[model samples]
Target: MQLLKDQERSQRAIKALIITPISLFIMISGFLLLKDNHFSQVATTLFAIVWGTVSVVSFFYSLNLIVQVFPLKYYNKIIPFVFVGPAILILGWYLFIPTLRSLYLSFLNRNSTAFVGLENYKYVFTDRTMLISFRNTILWLLFGTLFSVFFGLLAALLAERSSIEKIGKTFVFLPMAISMVGAGVIWKFMYAYKPAGANQTGLFNALMVAFGKDPQNWIGTAPMNNFFLIAIFVWLQTGFALVVLSAALKGVPNEIEEAARIDGASEFAVLMRIIIPSIAGSILTVATTILLAALKTFDIVFSMTNGLYGTEVLASQQYKQMFKFLNYGRGSAIAIIILLAVSPVIYYNLKEFNKREVF
Candidate 1:
């Protein structure tokens, strides 16, 4: 019996040694072939897809066969690393490496030729436009997050009792289907300004003209215009907030809510003292999500007003500094600042998610 077991283990080890290298070679060869355009482009694409698919299938199969050579205890320990190693490597290569490079570039000059320490950060803090951008970003974080969560909570509360909950959710979630740029374009038309005598193409201006007020440039005002842009973001994000918070709300034990009502607690009291606390994690999740979005807002500002009219945010300023003005140092500094601002909220969000998972 001992001799038979030894012979079986040796045979398995030999088979694994023979198959693993062949599987690896096939996978590499398939990947190389997939990158080539020597044949008709469509035919090459199709062939590569098949080749890659088969290679991956065979590779995994051979990997499992190789794992059989290991004892059960060793296989269990090694299997997790085998599955998770590629993702860790990819994240390090793409995210961690690039982030370090950006941080290093922040101390370099515009052409990245000379080292100019602290100058970019100084410019970011003291520049007039950048100051306005900081103020506007605060406003975006404040009002955008507030109104979005507020309206989302309101919608969730209302829809929970409504017969058409699914329909209501669908309509509210429709705006999320549109990209930020598309939403900006849609709202841009709504806020378009035309002179009093000519036809008012913009919906808001036309309504104003019908009410006998003169046509106004909605996107040309200073702080008020900033709020207008924030409104657009709120409109776009409220649905997401609603979806998440509503799910959280649904998770609240109905017995607790009923008991509160039975104890003579008002609906408002129940909501404030019981319901809100129950789903506080989800609320924080949505708030932090919107907060990050507001901080790094660029697309709507870029597409709608191009950050003119005191509407700049950190992301827009960074983009203009880097691409338009060719101020790479300043751009990198702004990016670092944005990352710093976002990191705390990200940490809190992840912590909340992890806590929720544990519970």
Candidate 2:
């Protein structure tokens, strides 16, 4: 009986190996034929649906068949790989392939029809508008990340001690419920300006009018407008930092803080030296996350100022290059530069995540 079972498993494994490739080839050929217009539109759609369904079923069937053929001890060891392999492949196909293509396109000309080497990169670094965009991007990263994290830390600390903790946090986090574009629209109203003698529809302008001052075009001001734009992002991200850092703070042992207090440490010292140090990792994590968000901020700026009046950042500039100016090379180069700038932060963040998982 044992010899028969072994022979049957071996034969089944051989059959699976043979059938898997054949099914895959058939699936690919069917799709290719459909793409070649060998079928009507309705038929083509049906064929695609059938092909996808069969492909998934056949893949798992083959996987299970192979697993059955393996000895039980080896099967247990290899099962994790069988499930994880497909996801890894999908992730690579979606992520790494496009990144490589973008990098290749960055070295090409405007239409991506000819090689331009580093010309696009040089323009990104030296062009007047590009330089301003770079400066604005740095400003956004610094101010947006700094203020968001600061306010978040403050909110987390204050909320933890508040009688109405949930209600207070819910209100502070209310802005987060608005989409970035929606928040931009709401703030646009807040920052809206009318002539000094008009009805003063904007909230800020109305306040100024009530206080006997003129209405100002807040977003039309050049460098100051950039900071005004950064404020919108800070408002949006503060809640995210608050939530993450608050969770981290909760994880810190109360015994340490109480002991510090008993040793004659002031409240300021306890927070500065004890609580902050205990949750330093979480702080760095939240800061890096907000930094990345600031680096890639587009919708808020695009919706509000549309990169006008010297409020452009790298992402907005890239959008103008690719869509408005139709300059693929310069756009891709800017994108690559942005990617390179954020890659280190992303790497460090991931490493910290791994460390947290390990410990």
Candidate 3:
């Protein structure tokens, strides 16, 4: 009873010590407002300085006491909180609070003063730019990620154990190292045009002229331009998907492949039945990753097409709203849409991971 009492007393003492300086700082800062004009400014700055200084000092003191109070035997259990507490607080401050604030802002008018209810969300559904944004977003979701995953998986299967596999893989994975902006710049040049004989710097137009065809503005067309930009994203991301899927492919047991061959399975049949099924988990992981990347894509589209030719995605549209149009409410609505859309992806990925752990 005495030992338990002593422990409880020490804990209470430590907690009190930890909170005392924080309370003092707040009180002193509040009291500084009562001073005269010149004195008040000086007092306020000093109050801020003192508040910051004392807070840091108190935090370290509290941490030191916490380490000493918790025994070495229980340190492992206690250390995680010490390490993760600041991160959790920061996440709450930056992610959770900002997200809640944005959602609240979304319900307000453009100036963020009036309660506009669902006007902003309604604009998202009905506005021409937003409708185009949704259509382009769907195209990116369907074609951008799908082609990357498909080509990646196909490449993984094709290059499994060939003699030149390493060289082929090195070539394929080269694009993953480049930044999205750099990839866009490179492809921009590739699709460049200058009205038939004004230097022919653009590779696509150059190729066309070589075939005696007129130089055309490739990135200015309607649906075709969208696909061309999507192809750039597909090229950049396929390398990442290929590398991960190929690693998973390499993990498949040799006995399984040999058994399939012994059963007189065709090469294609073996790949379809034995290999793909075995790596389904990895495939799903890669596909989900690519889909998420596609959903959040802004830099590639902004750098390449600048969301022109009716190619605005949700991310670019969010930027266009907030920065170009200066409509914070609509911008926040678009941001919330993206957050909600990604929340499901994130939840599914987490659930999938949990399922994998169980199996």
Candidate 4:
């Protein structure tokens, strides 16, 4: 039995080595052929689709064959890896490799020809525009996230008790369907400024005119303009928060609320003590998700203010450094900074998700 088992193991190992290389060669060759420019666009697309489908099926079939050759005792141990291993490798290739390359580039000069040590990082911390971006990003993180979660929670609660729940939610959620740039354009018209004497086209300016006040440049006003930009983020993200929190609210048991009320707890107390706590996990999840969005906000600032009027955020600064100014080092440094800033929140979010068994 032992000699037979050894022979089986040798056979399986040889088969595995042979099958792996052949499968990879075929997949890679097919991919190259599909990518060749000799093919027309339509032919390339059709070939790519067919090639991808065939490659996936063939790879899985080969993987299953390899797994089956292994003894039954090892089948369970290897099966999970057989399926998940490809994804892990793909992620490492795509995400991890690029990240390391960026880190290396961050230490180099603008054109990545020479080493700059920490100079780029110092510029990121001390530059005047970068300072403004940091301040604005903080405002976005605090106010944008706060208002989105607050209003979303309020809307969810109100909608839960209202007769026109669907209609109200539909209206409130409509802004989420619009792209961030589109929203900025729409709101730009709403915030459009004209000379005090000219007819106000903007809704806010028109309101000011109706009240006999001066028409203000909403996007051009410093400090206060930051809040207006933050408002756009809130409008875009609140619907997402509302939908998530609304589902969480439904998951709370009605029995707990009734019991608290029967024990003479007021509505406010019951809500604060019972309902909110019950769905606290979901709320944290929503808040963290929005927090990430706020941290990475670029489109609204880009479209509306172009980072002008003191509305610069981290992402906008990164864009300016990388694309506009072509400073790879500074851009990579700023990107790493943003990554560090959001990593802790992401960790916490994933931890909460794990506690809830969301995976």
Which candidate ranks first by lDDT, i.e. highest? 4
Candidates in descending lDDT order: 4, 2, 1, 3
Report the lDDT of model 4 for residue 217. 93
Tens digit of per-residue lDDT, candidate 3, span 136-254? 88899899988999999888877886789989888989998999999999999999879766779988898889899999888888877888888988998888889999999889898
Using Cα atoms with residue i matched to residue i, what is each candidate's TM-score against the true structure? 0.89, 0.85, 0.81, 0.88
* Per-prediction CA RMSD (Å): 2.8, 4.3, 7.1, 3.2
| Tens-digit per-residue lDDT, 180-290, candidate 2 | 999999999999988778898899889998998888999999889988888999899999999998898899899999999999999999999989999999899899999
For each candidate, the alpha-carbon lDDT, in order, equals 0.90, 0.91, 0.85, 0.92
- Candidate 4 segments whose C-alpha is farther than 4 A from its true place: 1-26, 37-50
Candidate 2 global lDDT: 0.91
Q: What TM-score would you give candidate 4 relative to the actual structure?
A: 0.88
> What lDDT is reached at residue 298 by model 2?
94
lDDT, model 2, position 40 = 86
Worst 10 residues of 2 by lDDT: 56-65
Q: After superposition, how far is residue 310 of candidate 1 from its true place, in Å?
A: 1.5
Residue lDDT tens for model 4, 21-93: 7788879998778666678899888888888887897798779768867787898899999899999999999
Which of the two, 2 or 3, has more TM-score? 2
Between 1 and 3, whose lDDT is larger? 1
Shift in Å, residue 133, candidate 3: 0.7
